[model samples]
Target: MNDRENLCLLHSKDLLDQKRLFLLFKRLAGQHSVSIAKNIHETIKEFNSATFTEDQKLFEDLYKIAATIENKVIDVDVLKQGVNKLLDNRKTIPQPKPEDLCVNDSVFQNKILSKENNQKTAPVPAVYDMLSLLYLTTNEKQRQQHFHDLTKYYYRQLKDHLKQLSIELDEILPLPVYEKKIKDFIPNAKLEVILHYLNQDAKEDTFTSELIQELYLYVLYPKINIEDCFKIAKEVVGIDYNFLSYELVEANGLLGALGQYYKLKLTINKAGDDVVLNLFAKFMIDFPKDAFPGGEDAFPKVGDAFPKDEPPTLSLQEEFVYTIFVPELKNIGLGNICDFLPRCYFMRSSDVMVFEDLTYSDYEAVNSEEPYSYEMLLLVVKKLAKMHACSLLYEEITSKGSGETTKINVQFSKYVMGFSQAVDTKFKDTIHYCNVNTTVNYVYNQFPDVAKEITMEEFRERSRDIFDSMLDKMKTSGKYRNVICHGDIWGGNILFKFEGTRPVDCSLVDYQMIRYCPPAQDLMAFLYINTDKNTRTNYLSKLINDYYTEMSTIFKRYSFDLSTVYPYEVFMDSCEYMKSYAVCQAAAYYPSSLDRKKVQDLLGSIEKTVRFFAVDKTEVLKVLMKHDWIRSRFREIVEDLYDLCLQK
Candidate 1:
């Protein structure tokens, strides 16, 4: 406790600290070079065994080790921080009790525990106390609001940093500066690839085709190699063959609802006779940069909807639908499931999916611009009901085996339509800001009587509320006896197998948006998107009754009582609840869906249509209204939405 004893103790502690500092530097130097690390280790060992008289020489040796580390270390910032902390401590002697002189493991742990206890017992700041109380007292909504605000604040900061970086790079900053900054911001960021994507001057068609070709090569070639094909021919077909060439089949301007299609023809010599196998290739399309005149700036609200860095989730979702969902249906005794599902041949995770071409079997997709006739609609609705029944039966069978009954199968709990966060935000933003606004504005323009009850803003607000309410209901578990609802049930997604002029059978394509939701969601969505106002008015009740009857029949076949699971009354009520959802979706998609022109065609060739439902929506609306196809279809959608809002 005396000054001389304390001084001696401090001196001893300083030597221990010096040894610890050298050990730290030696560990860091290992990352730079093994030889340098060895030298520092030896110096520390020698210093540790040195007498008090040799302290000056050891101190000089330690300085040299520090210099070596400073020069060679890759992480200079961390090394500098350690060194600076040691330097700062040198000015004041650390007081340690006589028991602390040993610096053993027990003593170190005790010190830490003692420090923590002291900190805990210390007087607390009032602000921190208030914060703790607030956190404990706040409800879910309040906590969500706070978290949302914090997220938005952080996002703004991040966006500001990105904007500044963009500006600095535009001014031709030195490469080294950006290299350091970018790595600090985004670990393992590929500057070259990002820059290439931003600066490429390739024409739109060439760029898209090249991307598709690259994806096709990456996905299909790996699965369809020569050896694999030879094995397939010998084992499955009983004919050994030479794998020949493959070529892309031209569709002549056919565009998919959510993707681009390419029919691939593969030729192989079977018994010296040329045999051709057709493969249907579907590639998940991103929002091409050239499709927007001002690039992301054109869609300010959803600029990052399809960022180059993040791949689209459509292919992966559809892959799940094929590999997990439909296969499970067959496993659970739904023998006719494959009749409705295209035989998927090869599917990559995010971009490319290959299937046995359904067209080869006389299955043809309905025109995207045309509504399905009542007979065709009836067939499609019954098929949808069967799919729902199979999903229910599968859940029932699996739950019974597991001894736990869940409302929805655990595998199908997550919503698949907007499985990715980016896509979900984009969809919600498009629906709320673009779809809701456009539909309301159209109503205001075309139907003054429909718009008479409220202002345009009021109508937008009410429509948004209605759509949000539908989303809430959809998200609610055990809502209306959920089924595996085909999230995008429409004409474009259905393929009819015809016998001469009449349709004999049908198969649903594009299972990208399957969700565990009420069957009414699929039913209403089908009617709203693929049927005109007149068609729905004339045959809506009939179609619903047919869907119910088919579903009841399938359930009865599987020994399920429809009344015990999903009653007819409950299905009708769910349909009424989802009516607004269907209307909102129809309004959003009709502008693009009703037109024969592809998204790129309208945005690229038509200057005024560049901001279609993305930006300057009113101007684009004016241009769209000029077209009879969009105007007529969009009017029906808006009229339905307006009526739904009035009822609300």
Candidate 2:
């Protein structure tokens, strides 16, 4: 057919198909300018008017708009290819057989041949997909028809019409390609709807769907090379594999506070033998403003306190522990070098770290809700003790060889908490400033009898004072031997390997917050944060002594004595001195952990959390005190702090 006849045939389509055709022209026009696309659409939209005198006049109008688009378009061939495809679909319009009279008739027939009768009777591609296949490709931009300009009624009407054609979309298009197609047509399509048309199941909720969608993007679109995989396989399993393929499983429930976790399952071949490797991948989210929950709204409020300056190095520090510090300690081969650290499988830049999946050996984190029993606490204590002992051994050996006192070279060793120079703004912005102050205020107002003459302002000031004291106590000051401290020691960071009901092996997982301090920094934090006051009352000395005995044995293996290096007397004093710091840490952490439902209630609106901390804690404290768990936890913590700091 000629250009005039083809233009008349395209104009004969129903409004939806006409709009689809307009999208093709618009896509062509978009290659030049969005305004040109708008001009072309408006010009063609006038074609349906009854007042239109002749096809030649209307065709000339469209041709004029096309001429303007051609001037600005850099690739004239691509534009012609798009326009030619649209005309070809119209020129070959088939007359439906009488038996297929029920099928909706349009210029472009949406049909496929039936396998049973070898007849063109099957309804396969929906009109939307058929039109999509006619003009668009995977490389096309993700442009959608703007629904913002449409009325709500018209929008729903158009959506219902398109939904009918979405049924056969899956059979004709791959998910990723189809996703780009449907989203172009339905600009406001929910993730669930897109997944439905693509024949992929979405997570139940919008939040989860968005979260899983992001994870799929990261996993499916890995910026990796074959050489990286080969190197990882060689180093991890001692296999030089020439081939590799892998699947990533996002650990949804185990998502990190400031990052993401995945189980990287690999299949590789060497010498015609296939070997499977399962490794854990940790992705550090450097900027929480974009990747994390609460987005920009909640980030500014929490950013000051929550690793604002530390995220870039958070993974780096953990990577250093896995790749350098731990490996060097292991090379020394101390008698008590228990297998407590995950084996590093791969390290990608500074954001991603891969390690041996501990679950393969039946190791798993204990339930954070359950309090640690004596046995559980004992295993963790022993592990920490051995790790601390190794750090001491390294320092001692290095110092002796160099004939000088050598310290760990890790930069994270500098204390960042409390009233330190490194984190003056951090302390005032986060837990210490908001949560701690809130807890103390709630305690004083609710229990004036127990609060005594210590005024509310004094109590708040005392909290800061305790942290200021903690900064001083964190230093060795030639009084105690410094050992590497797991800066964050809590239930979540310890993974336990159990045999039936018996507690057996355990590994200390997150080393992102490692510090060079006395062992009391970790021990007290673990004891106070993970165990209850009653548990500590009954077994505190035993736990401490158990840690000391473990370290003492390890030291004796190297012909050194713990008594000289870290005396039991000095250890006891350090624990006493660090109690205020531990209590403060517990109070800061309890608001989120003790009753997450209330925390969620508080954080339901990021604005609420931001508002809660933006001003004085008076009103928010009242809101927080309503939750029974929050009330009890903060009350107990205040009592502990009061006795530690304000008791006469």
Candidate 3:
């Protein structure tokens, strides 16, 4: 027979097996329920048909049957006895015809046989294989043995296909009602609930209690009360409790976002007992046009706005790392540094990602004020070097026989305009709230020695020009070797595991802003935002050396010569190029990183500084002088900039 005919015959055989199994289960359950009812009625005379109405007796029997199923009180001895009695009475029992066994007539037709052979092909023997044995064996003992084997085979098949029965039940009743009904039969009711939801053929318009129960079982806990299921559904899934109808559920502001996230959680399972999974569902759906100010126009598009080869969205970038980059890193025996990555359970496009919660391991994010210590800084530098080396290796592997120049798949240039625009907007708003000229004059007066080369006009002109061109300069500068940068490397993006006063390990998170740029972009941004002035000045050189050592070690492992690929001198020059970008970023972001009340206080002082310093007055200088932290930070930035300029 041809392959197609063979496949058709095999499928037909499976269908026949399923149909026979279904019939066997129906007969077994019916006989078992009747036998249990007879015994119950015999014990309780009041429940007997003679004492009670037929309908009432039937109802009581059904209730007892359900209770027995729920309590798992089925007796195997009684079941065997009942099956034996049924077999003995088979002469009086109606036999299912061949037509009844084959649900679809066309499926059993000659079309499934090889026409070239024109010979009847014997079907593959299966669970029903012993039927002919029973008839052929004239000896009572052999016939009985065949019957027992057939019964055992059919029962085993019935148990194996229970999930298929559940699917059939789902079609007969609504999923919620089907789930409730199956709970009595299944020990793991939560598994049934999860399976039912996942197997759903119809899309739901509103969140149902059944759906909430499934989510609670998977995302939160295995055993949860129904009331708490509703509560968690409301609190965690962002559903409304007051309105449980489809209208209200569909109208929920967070429904679309929650739906996508819920789908993601459903797709992933727990990795191990030690790891706690936490999904950061921070995405928004259908945001208002005014929310992003410029709407879709402000964001870059695929192919048109960014290179066609690069990943167009943050989700795609993260997906690439999890699927391609991380695995490649592990392949090269650098999985130790990869511990910083939360174990990715699964990722769907960019809309949904499930990760193991690192908090379970006592890892916490450091805030802006709490900078990384010298030891922690060394670990971070090593981690960054590993990350960069993996990217380099990935580029080499993907480019190997393509005969094309190796390039990182991420596009950093797309974000430059958007970031510059945001900085400019923030600057304008600050000037509108206070006075730019006044703020500059105040800084110049407060640090006359630092501002000796620049007048108020010069300071105003240079600051605006610097903000506008900073990203471009960082991108174009050949001082550093281009590498994949963890685009958002501030304190908030990193998590550390501390062993009492010292950070022994660290992990990076929030890969949404990953990009292709010089390694210094990440290095400088991380240092400036996560370290104090003294830490930056004193340990900067050592940290760079630490990063290079790690990078060189990784290269050597992969048989690449570091001298030609990325030398120490090239790295140092990259740091110089990154210095200007880092100082500007730190100054711009410093105010936002402060406590809310502190930010308000600083803004108030800024307003007063602007009013006084507008006409070259020194009153604002006193306010600036009071905030020693701010003054020190600015002083360090100016010193770094001055040194950079002198080098030029």
Worst 10 residues of 1 by lDDT: 44-53
215-238 in candidate 2: lDDT tens per residue?
223234343322244456667655
Of 1 and 3, the candidate ahead on lDDT is 1
Candidate structures ordered by TM-score, highest first: 1, 2, 3
- Superposing every Cα of model 1 onto the true structure, what RMSD results? 21.2
Q: Write the per-residue lDDT of candidate 1 for residues 415-475, one digit (tens) a residue.
A: 3434312323544454356555666665457655556677766777787787666565454
Model 1 TM-score (2 dp) = 0.58
TM-score of each: 0.58, 0.57, 0.51
**Looking at model 2, how many pairs of residues clash?**
0
Candidate lDDT scores, in order, read 0.52, 0.53, 0.45
- Provide the lowest-lDDT 10-residue window in model 3: 245-254
Can you tell me which runs of candidate 2 are displaced by over 4 Å? Answer: 1-219, 223-227, 242-244, 269-275, 288-312, 335-338, 409-431, 442-457, 474-478, 595-631
List per-candidate RMSD values in Å.
21.2, 18.9, 19.7
Estimate the overall C-alpha local distance difference test score of candidate 2.
0.53
In angstroms, the error of model 3 at 330 is 4.1
How many clashes in each candidate? 0, 0, 1
